[model samples]
Target: MAGTFYRVQCADCENEQVVFGKASTTVSCAVCGTTLARPTGGNASIEHEIVETVESR
Candidate 1:
């Protein structure tokens, strides 16, 4: 199976970052300490708007 990546923009700071779709841990914004995604049983739950889909290897 292929892993999915997402380019998400932080709502608080508008910081953009790439995150794994099936992340096992919480993801936060680099610029600001805002929560971006949370680990779920399946794909991660995104807290911010997704800007684009990123290709991962």
Candidate 2:
């Protein structure tokens, strides 16, 4: 199954970026290099603030 995308804001820099819900690798913030999400078998463990949930159209 396909996973959704999330618009996440970094806690340290407030930089907004897209992250995969089912990411297999660690996802980091673009501007601050902060940990945004991590792999957790299924849905990623999001650490930053999730501003929006993107649905595939």
**Best model number under lDDT:** 1
TM-scores of the candidates are 0.90, 0.91
Instruction: Estimate the overall C-alpha local distance difference test score of candidate 2.
Output: 0.90
lDDT of 2 by residue, 1-57 (tens): 777998999989889999989999999888878899999999899998999987753
lDDT of each: 0.92, 0.90
Off by over 4 Å in 1: none
Over 1-57, each residue of candidate 1 has an lDDT whose tens digit, in order, gives 778999999999888999999988999899988999999989999989999998876
Name the lDDT of candidate 1: 0.92
User: Over all chains combined, what TM-score does candidate 1 have?
Assistant: 0.90
Q: Best by TM-score, which number?
A: 2
RMSD of each: 1.5, 1.4
